[model samples]
Target chain A: AQSVTQLDSQVPVFEEAPVELRCNYSSSVSVYLFWYVQYPNQGLQLLLKYLSGSTLVESINGFEAEFNKSQTSFHLRKPSVHISDTAEYFCAVSDARGGGSNYKLTFGKGTLLTVNP
Target chain B: DAGVTQSPTHLIKTRGQQVTLRCSPKSGHDTVSWYQQALGQGPQFIFQYYEEEERQRGNFPDRFSGHQFPNYSSELNVNALLLGDSALYLCASSLGGSGNTIYFGEGSWLTVV
Candidate 1:
């Protein structure tokens, strides 16, 4: 079985400050990584994903995550964040070998990012 | 294009009663997956449907069941609901392939008392 661990439960930072949300996973085989954001009373939106080729992936909202194979980590980072970035972020993983409709994702508990003015 | 959509945005039910939730997958998506999100917890996979068949399921009890229609829409039915069943039920859709991006709906909020 595969699982994701997000070390931070809550991270508070001032607006325009840089932040990093840590994530680690445990899997026997290679896996695809993804980051999702959820705002209050809304569904999740994909921030970015790391399927293959590039280890570093960026989202249009100035957020990025780097997939480190050996370390089993895909930490999300931003040089600066806006108040609109405040939300709960989740790290998820799925087996790279699992194809077709059999694919399923395992997600972390989630990290709440609060950007204050 | 419209994203995934779920019906009965909010519902209240009593224990031992049954409840049903509906979902319409995003355009161009063939696979629909259901998830349960408890308060303050990440979404937990319930099952996935493709070609009108269940392709994958999570560790849920028999009380939890689902169906997919020919149009790729899906429904989640819960029998003998427990207080613990009260949560946000999310529906997601994706292309039937490995490493494909999955889009989620706002979710149906169920309250079991």
Candidate 2:
């Protein structure tokens, strides 16, 4: 089975400060990794995904995540965050070999990112 | 195009009661999946519907059932609800084949008293 672990339950950072949300996964086979952001009472939005090609993937909002195969990590980073960046971040994994709901995602508990002013 | 949409944004039900949540997939999407998210926890897969049939199901009990319409809409029904069932029910839609992106709805909040 595949599983995702987010080391931080919560991260507090001031606006304009850099932040990193740590994520690690355990899976027997190759996997697709993703980061999602959820604001209060809203659905999750895809931040970025690591499918193929480059080991580093970036979102449009200046956030990026590097897929580290040896470390089994996909940590999300932002050079500088703003108040609008405050949300819950989730790390998820899906089997690279597709079949039925096996394509379904296994997500970590989530890290609440609070960008303070 | 409009994204995945779920109905009954919030509702409360008593134990032993039944509840149903509805979802309309995004335009051009043919597959629908349901998930249950407890407070402060990650969402858990419930099932997936494709071609108006159930393609996959998670470890949920028989009390959890679902249906898919020809129009690609779906419904999630839970019978004999328990307090543990209180959580946010999310509906996600995607294309049937490989490498498709799945989009989620805002979710329906179900509270079992």
Question: What are the per-residue Cα lDDT tens digits for candidate 2 across A1-117?
Answer: 799999999999999999999999999998999898999999989899888889999999999999999999999999999999999999999888864233688889999999999
Clashing pairs in 2: none
Question: Fraction of true contacts kept, per model?
Answer: 0.61, 0.42
List ranges where model 1 is wrong by over 4 Å: A100-102
lDDT of 1 by residue, B49-103 (tens): 9999998899999999999999999999999999999999999999887667899
Compute the lDDT of residue A117 as modeled in candidate 2: 95
At residue B20, candidate 1 shows an lDDT of 95
Pick by DockQ: which candidate is best?
1
Q: What is the DockQ score, from 0 to 1, of model 1? A: 0.63
lDDT of 2 by residue, B37-103 (tens): 9999988889999899998788899999999999999999999999999999999999877667779
Please state every model's RMSD to the true fold in angstroms: 1.2, 1.3
Where does candidate 1 chain B have its weakest 10-residue lDDT segment?
Answer: B95-104
